[model samples]
Target: MKILVAAAAGMSTSLMVRKMEEYMTANGLVGVVDAVSVAEAKERIRECDVVLVAPQVRFELAGLHQIAEPLRIPVGGIPAPIFAGMKGEEAVRLAQDLIAQAAEPTS
Candidate 1:
């Protein structure tokens, strides 16, 4: 799985991505996690399994959904608390949940 994390400048998400990477390594999960600006995300979405926007960029979610929904890619905003605290485990779990939901057949 490839997860894309988007933030305003993209720099702030590096730490979050690192933490998520650590969690993945400790848990024996294999995947790629990248940090990108919202602009970059538009072009990179196709390569990612999940897209997570920082709380500061939640306003961009609608625009991202416009691109991701058609591709069956899951896009979500990281919770403010989780983001502010740089909680990687929770974020990873959230991404996993989104992936699971996307795999479910719609009723």
Candidate 2:
């Protein structure tokens, strides 16, 4: 899976990206993780399998949905607890769960 973490500026989300990357590696997941600004996310959305919006940019979730929903990409906000030194594994699990749900056909 390809995961994109986005914020107002790409720099801030770099930390989360690192955490995500570490989680993926440690968990034996095969995927790539990238960080980008929201504007960049718009262009990169189709390339990603899942999109994670930084907590600080939660307000932009709707816009991200506009871009990702049609693509069937799961876009989610980083939980506040997960953003505040919570285990990276937790966030990774959230993304994993979302990816699973996205893959399912709506009944």
- Clashes (backbone N, CA, C under 3 Å), per candidate, total 0, 0
Clashing pairs in 1: none
Error of 1 at 76 (Å): 0.2
Q: For residues 1-107, could you state the per-residue lDDT of candidate 1 as single tens digits?
A: 89999888655688899989999999999999998899999999999999999998899999999999999999999999998788989999999999999999999
Model 1 spans with C-alpha error above 4 angstroms? none
lDDT by residue (tens digit), candidate 2, 38-72: 89999989898888888888998999999889889
Model 2: number of backbone collisions: 0
Worst 10 residues of 2 by lDDT: 8-17
TM-score of each: 0.96, 0.91
Each model's lDDT? 0.93, 0.84
TM-score for model 2? 0.91
